[model samples]
Target: MLNFVDWLASTSGSIALRESLYMYPWIESAHVLFIAIFFGTLLFVDLRLTGYGFKNLSISQMNSKILPLTIIGFILMITTGLLLFYALPIRNYHNLFFRIKLFLMLLAGLNAWHFHRTMNRQGKAWDKNSFIPFWMKASATISLVLWGLVIISGRMIAYNWFDCDKQPQSELVNFLISCTVDPEIYEYLNGI
Candidate 1:
C-alpha cells in the first residue's frame, strides 16, 4: 500500500502538469495568492460568527455574498496546490512539515463543514442569542489556528530543518510516508 501511494503521488497530474519551465513557480505563486484570499475571507466570516464585527449583515446573507469568493479562492488554491505538489511529489511526500500541513488542512475542512451543518440546523437562535455558543467560538478559533499552522507548516517545508535523508526514524514520519509512499525513502535515509 505504501508503494502504491508513493507511486500514485509521483504519478498524479499535479506533478506531471508542470514539467514546463517556470510554470511550476507561476502556479505555486497563484496557489499562494489564492490561499491568501481564502484565508482572508474565512477570517472575515469566522470573526463575524464569533461576534467580532460585521454588525449590519445577517450571517446567512453575509455567507451568500462571500461564499462565492471563497469558492473561487478554493478552486484556485486546490488547483495550484495540486500542481505545485505534483511538481515535486517526492520532496513533499517525505517532508514532515508537509505531512503536518496536510493533516491541518483536512481538519480545517472538516471543522468548516461541521460549522456549516450546525448553522443550517439552528433556528435563528444564533442571531437572537447575545453571546455566541462556546462551541461555535471554539470551532472558529480552531479554524484560525489550524489555518495558521497550515501556512506555517508549508513555509517550514522550505527550510530543510531536517531533510528526510538526514532525519531520525519515528512513528510520525513512518505514518506520513505510508500516506504517500513506501517507508524506504525514510528508512534508507535514516539507516545512515
Candidate 2:
C-alpha cells in the first residue's frame, strides 16, 4: 500500500497537481467551498429530523427542498477531495488525522444510509407529522457529531504533531497507524 502511494505520488499528474503554483490552492479552496454547501444543507435536514428546527416543515418537504443541494455539494466536494488526496497521497496516507477522517466518514456514510432506509420504510405515515422516531432523531444527531469530528480531523491533517518523523507516538499509537506495514517506509520514517 505504501509503495502504491509512493508510486501515485511520483506520477506526473500528482506531481503537477502538488507542485502547481495555483492549482493545488484552487482545488483546496473548491473543496472547502463544496464541503460547506454539502454540510450546510445537510445540517438543516438533520436539525429538522431532530425536531429542533423547521417545525412547520414536513420531513418530506425538507428533504425535497434541501437534499438536491446537499447532493450537489457532496459530489463536488468528493471530486475536489480526490484531487487533494491525489496531490498528496503519501502525506495524507501517513497522517493520523487523515486516517481518523476516513474512519469517521465511513461511519457518517453508514448512519446516513440507515437514516434514509428507515425514513423510507416508516416515513410516509409520519412524513407530515411532528412525530419522528427516536432512532431517527438519534441517528441525525449522530450524523452531526460524526461529520463534525470528520471536519475537525480533516483540518487537523495539516498539522504534523503526530507525523511519523515526530517519533513521539507510543507503541499502541504506532500500531493504530499501522506504522509497521512497510518495513522500508517505517525505516525511512524512523531514520528521519
Candidate 3:
C-alpha cells in the first residue's frame, strides 16, 4: 500500500503534472474553500433545525432548500478533500491530528447519515411540528461540533505533528511529534 501511494505521488511529477508546485497547493486550496462552503451552509441549516434562525419558515421548507446546497457543498468538500489527501498521504499517515480529523470526519458522516435515515423514517411528522424533536436537535448539535473538531484537528496536524524540523532523518516519517521548525507559519504560536 505504501509503495502504491508512493508510486501515485511520484507519477504526478511527470510533465503532465508538477505535483508539488501545481497539484498540491491547488488541491489544498480547493479543500479549504469547499470546507468553508460546506460549513457555512451547514451552520445555517443546523441553526435553523435548532430553531435559532428562520423561525417563520417551516423546517421542511428550510430543509428543502438548504439540504440541496449542503449536499452540493459536501460533494465539493469530499472531492477536494480526497485530492488533498492523495497529495500527502504519507505525511497524513504519520500525523496524529490528521488521524483524529479522519476519525471525527467519520463520526460526522455517521451522525449525518443516521439523522437522515431517522428523519426520513419519521417522515413529515417532526417537520410539521412547531418544535423540533430532541434527537434531531442533538444530531444537528453533534454534526456542528464534530465538524468543528475535524477542522481544528486538521490545522493542528500541520503544527503539532508534521513539522519538518522535528521529522527524523529517515526515509519515512511514521508518527506525529511536536518539534521546532524554521519558517513558522504561525508567527504568534511561539510557545507552541
| Candidate that scores best on lDDT | 2
Q: Which ten residues in a row have the lowest lDDT in candidate 1?
A: 173-182
**Segments of candidate 1 deviating more than 4 angstroms:** 5-19, 167-192
Which lDDT tens digits does candidate 3 get at residues 1-192? 667756665665332333457776777788788888889889988998898887777777888888888789889988877666666666555566777788899999999999989877874787656676798899999999999999899778767434444444222332333223443434434434
Against the true structure, whose TM-score is highest? 2
- In terms of TM-score, how similar is model 2 to the real structure? 0.89
Ranked by lDDT, the better of candidates 2 and 3 is 2
**lDDT per residue (tens digit) for residues 81-126 in model 2:** 9999999998889888999999999999999998899889889876
Candidate 2: regions farther than 4 A off: 181-192
Provide C-alpha RMSD values for all models, in order: 4.2, 3.7, 7.0
Please give the lDDT score at residue 178 for candidate 3: 26
In terms of lDDT, the poorest run of 10 residues in model 2 is: 178-187
Candidate 1: residue 144 Cα off by (Å)? 1.0
Q: TM-score each candidate.
A: 0.79, 0.89, 0.77
Candidate 1: tens digits of C-alpha lDDT, residues 10-81: 664645564667787788788889999988998888787777778687777667778789889988898888
Ranking by TM-score: 2, 1, 3
lDDT at residue 58 of model 2 (Cα atoms): 87
- Model 1's TM-score against the true structure: 0.79
